[model samples]
Target: KSKFGTDLNEVPREISFCSHTITGNKAHVVPDLSKDSRFVDHPLVVSGPLARFYAGVPLVTADGYGVGAVCVLDTVPREIAPAQLSGLEAIARQIMSHLNSRNLLESERQLSTQLSQSKRQLDDFFDLATDFLGICDINGHFIKISHSFLKVLGYSEREFIYKPFTDLLHPEDVEQTINGFISLESGVQLGLSNRLRAKNGRYVPLSWNLSSNVDGLVYAVARDMTKQYELEKNLIQAKEKAEAAASAKSRFLANMSHEIRTPMNGIIGMTSLLKGSIDDEVNIERLNIIQSSGDTLLELIDDILDFSKLEVDKIEIEKQALSVRETIQDVIGLLGTKASQKDIAVKYIQSKSVPAWILGDVTRFRQILLNLLSNALKFTERGSVEISSDATPTDDGQWTLTFAVKDTGIGISQENIAKLFTAFTQEDASTTRRFGGSGLGLAICKGLCEKMGGRIWVESYLGQGSCFTFTFNALETTASTEGRKKDPFAQIPTDLGSVKPLRILVAEDNRTNQIVISSLLKKVGYTPVLVFNGAEALELLEKECFDVILMDCHMPVLDGFQTSKAILQKFSDNRRPYIIALTASTQKVDIDLCFSSGMDGFLSKPITVNPLFTALDEVYSKIHDQVPSDRPIGIDKNVSLTRKQSKKQD
Candidate 1:
């Protein structure tokens, strides 16, 4: 072909001689292009540039792709030497090697730029994070620390770097910190907490999470726990203070109850004794007034104590078989005097669905009815009060009984009904002034109803009477109702001539209480030996054998509990006297304590003729081996009759 120029550089592959060389792995040589059959019609030889001789070598890449060729062409036909073709192949390989190397260098430059940008982003993130981030060397030295770590310790980066990590720890925490680091080095992740000494010289609490790599460097994240620790400490202190206050309140209530009930018992007991002997109608009426006022005062004290017990969740519910109708009748009888004074009629209606006997807390049940009936009678000056009861059966074999007390008194307003059940609240300030009350009666009733698995509510309107309703859960029981209706004094003979003898002993420290108890026993044909205190009673017991010992709980010398326990230890079951506890305190805890101290029965004082006769009859029944008509409150009939022989010995 002609001399190489820019115009020939643009030849298309289909008519180009170099295209043939590029198709093979080696050089292509045409000694005479006109004589070669494959190139006989070649464009360059026929017209453009008549070439008689040609030689070319393929420019193959390292991966064996032939892109183009290096060639020599001449117009005159000539034979190509082997040496010449080898020289052309070497030139083609050298050109391919130079192109490959240049492309690789450009790619490496781009990669280096990307890596530099990534490193800058990581450094920015490390400095900007708020959490305390740090790295420690194998020796527990701070090799790297973030800005947050330096700021929290009040130290500059220069002062913290390369410093021992434990240097900032509280003296009490250094040993644990060292152990934690050692654990981290053994491929264990660690969670640690310690107090760190800050620049202000005050120790700051910190919580940390640490991990280690094979490079012997520890990576850590920490949080300042100063506020959290202080909060926890404050919460603990508050809880302790609350417990102390509660304990103090309980002690105060118990003391007040004992002090108040002691005088109340005397007032009521003496009034009862005075009434039995007086024949004048005016004097008897005056005595009744005195007894009624004393009962009102005692009820006020009970309300306060009950509310306090309920507030602290200390009131316990007792399950016993009780007659629903009898219990209601008893409550009605209790308020009957008040109703008579006001000239108001009191009625009770019982539905057939209400079982005769149901399992429940009889005392609390009576208390609820008493509170409701008392309120109704107090408000109704001239109208009638009605109490109705009905029961609904549940699928679980239990019964839900509902009782309602409707009064036609000075009716409550709609707004006042909302506040009726709240403690220390009444209809208004005028109501408190006119109708005196502690305003805790309804609240106590609510608390009692809930304790018995029930709820209480009221419905009323202005100028209309109010209706208070309550519901409780109970199980149907087949308990006998024979003795429950018997008169408590039925066994005591009116004429003392034919009375069975009982050797009774009364141990009371108070002079008035001793006289009142002795006179009551005498009235019932029982002549009891009297003593001043529990110690005196124990002394008398050592010298005499008595059938019954009525022990007062609180006295000057040895208390009744200690005296009872001593008696229990000194005498065998068959020889010990039938001990009965008499106390002014009516708390359940106190009653339980009485029984635990080996007393067979308990009686709350300001003793009256009925309960006093009941207790004596119970003791006599045990002695004579006859089942009395009624058992006294808190008497355990199942107590072994081994003590029966004590009376025979006496």
Candidate 2:
């Protein structure tokens, strides 16, 4: 603007000289634009810088897209010397060169501005991020930590940097945190929760998001999880407390069950002993009622305890040889009286395909059948309850035994059938009231069936009846369950009076129980020397030899378990008496304990004549086996023969 007369910097593209020159590949020279038809009507030519002399060249980039142009314009037409004209062209090239250089400088300035802004944004993000950002070396040492890290954990950069990341973690978390570094290079990892020790020596839970930087560094963003962790801890503690309360309740139930059964054993035993002596019909009828009531109470107790055990996963099913036919027949025999009274005939159907014996839990197996059959009988007024079993052999040397209990009774609606096997749910309220049951039998059966690798279901229609079926997979056993199980009283005389009485030591503490047990022994023609506890029994055994020792598992001073162990250790095997454990505990663990502790036999109490007689019979049979056939029978009269057998073999 200083050198030229005026400036047309604001001119429109229509009459712009720079725009016209940009269309040409090189300089355009017009001595007078008004003489050219293209610019004759142009505004700049006709109105302002009129009759212009123009010399212009395009401002071309390196890629050759012309953005603008530089030109010299004069108000009047002019002619120059040839030398001056050539000089002007050279000057125009120089102008283009300057224009290119100016554009380059301007682009560099824009790029510099962009880079500065980008850096500012990145720095802002790094310092102000909500997550605790950090960079660690491959060795897990902190190289740099964001201000958020210091803010979140209350640690200064000097105090945190260069220290191992694991050093800041909770002691228990160190190993796991360190292990994460080795494989982190594979990909980004996030949302891993860990406990970190803060500067103030308090634990801060952090959920981390991490990734591997191409340059041997670990980048991490950690979110504070202390509150979430505390909530989870509270939930866990509540769960633990609930579990503890449940465990205590179970313990109380088991103890109470043991405690209650002890007295009931005495009562049932006394009742059994007195039943035959009572001649009055009314007294006999009353005794029957008492026994039935006691039995029902026993069933209820058993159901409650069994269900509790199942709930706790404490029930263990044994894998052993079991007889399906015999087990079913036995159930039928036990329930025969009830079935006869109701005039509902029961039948057992078995296909020849079913194996004689299979490996399974015999107790649970029988329980399943008993529950289904008993349920069938309760519903059926007069129709038959048919229990059938058939098995299909499996590829793994096993058999799938499908059992069904079909019955005719007030059939369940489709909706109610689903509720049948659930605990405390029977057909209906009226049915439960009239039929009389705890409604836990089928639930227990279902639990037992599932535990034994089987499933149970029912098919029924209204007014028609119900058929309850279950399938069990069992491994074939070479030995028969019945053949291997000998009748304990088959060889022994049940009339204890007929057989000569053996010298017996009864370890019992309760006064009433002592008299009752002694009376029963006396009635059976055996004189028992009763000791108050295991210590008393031990003391008595030191001085005298007895043919049999009836030990109560739980007593005041030194229970039966300890006493039996002491007796076995003290006496030579050949001289040891046949020890039988008398316990009110029908728990499998307790029975297993009795046998494992080397008792000759187990007799669960409220001891009826049958159990007592069976224990005695088994004891005698075991003694007979222990006695060496080669040795003189008198050498070891009625005790386990020692391995040495010094009296005879030596």
Candidate 3:
């Protein structure tokens, strides 16, 4: 508010309202007030009054509360008409109305101030958050943004505001940006994730949520997902690579099994023939050598099969009663010769507290012991190897069996220990050369231990010794099961009666195995009719009957599977011959082929007499009646069975 004035320092009491207030009259209203007696007589008004004639009305709050007044002043006052007074009064009322509006506006202004302060605090909090926050307009321009958005995006406030949201979008996500904004404008609340171009021009994966505010504003929050996305992608690629490698390995194993078994079959076969014909002492010693070679071949096959099972993660454990004392004896019996060869004392630390029979997977438990003992024997030269066990109760009322294998061998160094459990990795490359093994034993043991709800680890010192420890659940065996009879496979032969003579037919493409199989068969009174391949076997079946067909699955012309199928078709109703498929293919599908082609049994190569006999006994009844008087015989080294037997003999 301003006062009307005239000459320098002129003051008046009575002031004109309309003219002074509206036109900002400084001299006219003030000088008029100075001439008036009432105003002139007044001391303050007479003393060069800047306010000559003043008029004002009290301003009121919106709630009718009076706060202050607005006044209009002039320097002079003179006689005035009723119309002018009415005009003055009207102008006074108008001024009062303006004052009331100002009060209401002031109240609103205070409220606005408080709101602005609260919004700033909220903005500060959102800016401090790690997650990105932003506001965009209908035109896709950024209206507001948080500090994190700047930190994560490497942008400043001036750089971000009024900039199109799509300007920061990755080229691949441009369409997605357009779609998202279109959806927001169409009243759609969208939560999306994609890549965005950062200030550094690198694309970063981001996840975000967007919603419309009451004022038609879009609020968005985002999080950087670049690292997480990359990790998941790498994991998927790794999984695929592993699966492919495993598939290739399985195929290679199947092929190797076939290749090894073909030659082994001939060696064992020819040894059988030699046993029936030769009776010299020298021949007997030769027979022992042949049998030992066959055993070695069989052991190699077993290791490969075990490795295959471990590779595919299919080793299953079935719990049953097993004799601890007998298992220890069995391990000692099997590995004793190997230890003796190295002059290593191998023994078990038998505890009196150990139950004679315990419930566990006999096969797996035996395997564990075998792996540990084998490693000890291979690594140790002069010191003793000890296997011991201790039993305790767990918190869950289960028994815990802790087993340890301590060996005083060429101990593992710390460097080797770090990679000990990795497949195909030994203490050193020389370890593989010195100790012949695939280096998969410990890895297989670890996997088996984990599957059985346990863990295995080792402690060793270079040149001192090594101690391998593992824990497993100690299962309780019922008295009836504990005292159960030993399985037939577990029984050692007092005489050769357990070894049965076999009348077999071998269909294979390899020559050495045919000779081996022929000798081995003759020794055991197994009259084997040899065929070079599956096609020849089919032709032979038409003329002579065989007790069992040890049909090699991989062959030229008609495969073993097709021959088996043809044999079944030829005798669909009659007493079908027991067809035992012999192949190196250990894949489940390959094994299934035997069954699908009407095979009565399946024996994977290199076939040991144990599994072969088991299969024969399961399928054939007359196998025991045709025993030959001859003993085990030496295989002919020069005979290659791949040369057709029928033509060569003729």
What is each predicted model's overall lDDT from 0 to 1?
0.81, 0.75, 0.68
Best candidate per lDDT, number? 1
Rank order (by TM-score, best first): 1, 2, 3
Q: After superposition, how far is residue 143 of candidate 1 from its true place, in Å?
A: 4.1
Error of 3 at 441 (Å): 3.4
Off by over 4 Å in 2: 1-131, 135-202, 207-218, 271-293, 319-326, 355-362, 475-491, 494-503, 515-527, 545-548, 561-580, 588-602, 608-650
Cα lDDT for residue 326, candidate 1: 88
Q: Clashes per prediction?
A: 0, 2, 52
Q: Where is the poorest 10-residue window by lDDT in model 2? A: 629-638
lDDT by residue (tens digit), candidate 1, 272-389? 7787676899998898789879987877777888898899887878778899998999899877877888899899999999999998888889989998888888887777999999
Cα deviation at 103, candidate 1, in Å, is 8.6
TM-score of 1: 0.75
Score residue 357 of candidate 3 by CA lDDT. 66
- Residue-level lDDT tens digits of model 3 in 271-373: 5455546679799669857966786676657666666777677556667777777886788777877888888887777666566667777777877888888
